[model samples]
Target: MFPTLLIVDDEQPILHSLEGLLSDEGFNVLTAPNGYECLKTIDAEHPDLVLLDIWMPGLDGIETLREIKKSHPGIPVIMISGHGTIDTAVTATKYGAFSFIEKPISIDKVIVAINNALNFRKLEEENIFLRTRMIAKNAIDGSSGPILALKQQIIAAAPTEAGILITGENGTGKELAARTIHQFSTHSESPLITVNCAAIPEALFESELFGHEKGAFEGATAKHIGRFELADGGTLFFNEIGDMNLANQGKLLQVIEEKRFCRLGGSRVLDVNVRIVAATNKDLRQEIEAGRFREDLYFRLNGVPLHMPPLRERLEDLPLLVERFTQSWCKSAESQPKSFTPEALETLANHDWPGNVRELKNLVERLLITVNKETIDLSDLPMPYRTPDVQVPADGLDELAGISDFKEAKAAFEREYIKRRLAECGNDVSATAKSLGVSKSHITKLIKP
Candidate 1:
């Protein structure tokens, strides 16, 4: 679709000329004779770009520009004037005007300015889209009780400036939880700087946290901004924060308390304004007891503690999680959709997912890649995931043989299969449905209430 442009000027001749020229230049043009009409046109049409004369009678160009910015900040406006001055241009720019062109407006210059403004708006739109997608991708998936509670906690804590500490087993999505929190926080539009506490060497911890000036150390050729400085007005996430050494922990505590630190080899102290979010799989209480972690630091960082549940605790969500992974993998690979058989899902549900959701996602991707068929069966599962099929006793088989009708015999076998599966799964209806690759209602209907 062609971009729409609104031209606002007191002079009728200028509007008529520009409207014809812009229309011929492949634009949808809307004309307004003055500032009052311009604001009305904007309210009605929501044009992509506006060209307004600076010296209009009522509401004036500067006033109209201010109103436009207040109401629709995304729309770009270019100021036009017959008697332009540096002061006027600066004022227009201060009020968020995209560009300023003097009167006897050159059509070429107007078109160029219009194109640049539109491109800038397009880039801004794309950035908003990408950020939204990033947030969705990092969102924690599952409707289990534990997951719902975690989500509520995140929502409550995210808008505040308080510190957050996320604790969970490895691969339980600690980092993912941090990203989701930051994306929802007040500083969502700002940077989220991450520092892996366990990865940095002991000697360089201060330099890494408080930055370093040139000639600070042997390899410090130029000044370097540390994670704290980079995350100003945003967030600083520390991964494996429990692994930080005792010596560095003291320095960290002082900085957190003081909110100011001097860069290495620099005497001037820089004040920091950053929200802190840390995650660890280790139990901080145990570490503190062992004298490895500082008790004070733990209390400081644990303002709003959140725990991510391990996958085995939410087995009822497995089928949904599996389907989500399958769809994601299929879309990325540009391949045909794949699904797991009921028996295969049951086998997966039985396994103790020590590695949590991450492990399950990895296994799903591996299966989709290796299993060529659209329907992945239990036999396709690797040795560790597979389980023995239900076997019928000879007497039970004889009883089935007594049913002469094929439909009756089939129904008898299905009932027996579901009963044995249910027993094996400790009578979990959800697990039974997953294993059978059928709805829970289907399984419930076959079983005696």
Candidate 2:
């Protein structure tokens, strides 16, 4: 696309000359008679660059520049004036004008200014894109053994066309794992379409997945492309797939089994080349046994099982995660970088993290916004994560006294913690499980002894 330029001047001959000159130089030119007309044209057509004469009847170039800077500061504006003064030029520059050219305009100088401004905008856009991609990659950043293994597993599975089923607690980075795979795959350039099974209504399932033709159903005023077709030659991520009803499970199974599906109210068979990646926090085996999920669908979806360990289990990576979150958030907030005290980091690592990595990220952001100190201490942590008093009896350590390995010690500590929480919650299995950030099945196992 050619860069568009909007020229604003009260002189009719000047407008005609600039428009013709810029147009001949491969610019899409727009002419406005005065300041009001310039703003009106700007609102109607977002031109890449603007040229304004300082002397106007109603609103002059300086006033116009201020208004433009307030709303569309990204656009570059050049000031033109015949009665040019040092003060006038400085004021234009102060009001955010890109450059100044005298009334006797030099075509060469104008072209050079136009190219420089456009190139500047392009560089700014590229920086934003690179930063966004870096942040996405950092979403899965971890150095713990489990995370290392998970990364290696993703690297191996990404190149294949096989389906992936990711299981873990909520906020365990299941979606991030799927994205990591997509980024490393042959279809990395293609879209990674996502559908949250739990969020979609059961009534809209067919239309949502297969799309609908115009007048196919109520509110089908126009033809719609469903998730399946939209994800052609890409990836389809079914988040919380276990939440899908059994009836929908069978329909999805059919789609997976045969890559071809017909749109609703349409007979044409459309073939799609999409890789399926599913995630769930629920135990699908139990769901299958209970007849809430289909056994056949389970076998088909679990092509390469990937499980994300909860944050508590990967406590060794807390420091790295905290540092990354801090750097990322602080940069976004445009503030000086903040460091966490050793005591504070240790407190964060020791927590159960029921909400997992997401919970930690939220805490970091909260601290960044709320805490005024340069160094975050234990006191800066939320009340729940701060050092707890009198929760676990000293006698609890006796059972796991000889467990020297970090993993074994953590397991023992978690088991004992769950036991105390259960007693405190009055043996309410559900409440205890919720408080401790584990599933009921896990709590039951802890109470087996």
Candidate 3:
């Protein structure tokens, strides 16, 4: 679509000339005789760019500029004046005018101004779209409950400059939560840099966090910007923060407290404006007690703590999650989406999801690729999850009769059968938990007593 431009001037000759010139330049042009008509055209057409004459009857250029800025700040407005002065131009610029063009304006300057303004408008629109997409991906969807309440709390707290601490088991969407908070934050327009504290080598932790000057250490050839410095005017997400070395923790504390830090082997301090969001599967409280984590740093990072419940706690949402994953996978893979039979869904929901949402998503993708059936059924499940071994014997026993409480007996037998299978799986908690369709923590709790 051609970009739209609105030209406003009391002089009929100037308006006709501008309309013809802009139209010849491949722009969709709308001409108005005065500021009042210009605003009305703006409301009606929502033009991408505006050319307003400074000396108009009734609502003048300055007043019209204020109204346009208040209503549609993104629309670029260039001021035109026949009796142009430095003071008038400065006033127009202060009131958010894109540029000022004097009367008997050069056609080339007018075209250039309109083109630049339209380009800026495009960029602003794209940024808004990207932000919206990020927020949509992070939004929580489900029926009302504690999960809904938690989502609301996160949204409410996201815009603040608070340092958030997110705690959850692996694959429980801790990263998603952190992103959601950052998306709605004051620093949303800024970058959100992530560092995996557990993944980084301990020897290089300081240089990584605080950066290093050229030749600061062995193999340090060039000056580098650290994650903290890069995240200035934005957010820094430290994943698995509990795994950071103790010595590095103290340095991090000083930086967080002072909002300034010097690069390694550098004398000058660099100031930063960054909000911190840290996440870890490990219990930081326990780590602190064990002297593996700093308590002072913990307090600073835990300005607002959000705990993401494991998948088992919100099992009711599993069906919806599964459908969402199935659709997502199909789109990415360019294949027809698959659906699970009621029995299959029940089996899926009953099994403990050891790896949480990540595990479930992986399984869904696996099923989409491997399972050929139009509808996944019980028999289509992998070996360990097909059915309890003891159920085979029960199937034969129904003919023998005299089993008055068969339901309770079946339940007991199934429980014991799963326990035996779990043990046979080497007590590799995650594997056993996945086979049994339960969370690793739940499996641990079961076997603990």
Best by lDDT: 1
Q: Compute the lDDT of residue 191 as modeled in candidate 2.
A: 79
- Which candidate tops TM-score? 3
What's the CA RMSD of model 1 in angstroms? 10.2
Q: Could you tell which candidate, 2 or 3, scores higher by lDDT?
A: 2
lDDT by residue (1-449, candidate 1, tens digit) is 99999999999999999999999999999999988888889999999999999998878999999999999999999999999999999999999999999978889998999999999999999999998999889988989999999999999999998899999998899999999999999998899999999899999898888999999999999998988899988999999999999999999989889998899999998999888999999999999999999999999999999999999999988998999999999999999999998978988999899999999999999878755558887756876776555322343556887899999999998898777667756798886676557899989999985
Off by over 4 Å in 3: 383-449
In angstroms, give how far residue 439 of model 1 lies from its true place: 40
| Clash count per candidate | 3, 0, 3
1 against 3, candidate with superior TM-score: 3
For model 1, what is the alpha-carbon lDDT of residue 328? Answer: 99
Each prediction's RMSD to truth: 10.2, 16.1, 9.3
Error of 1 at 122 (Å): 1.2
Ranking by TM-score: 3, 1, 2
Regions of candidate 2 where Cα sits further than 4 Å from its true position: 1-139, 389-449
C-alpha lDDT of residue 382 in model 3: 71
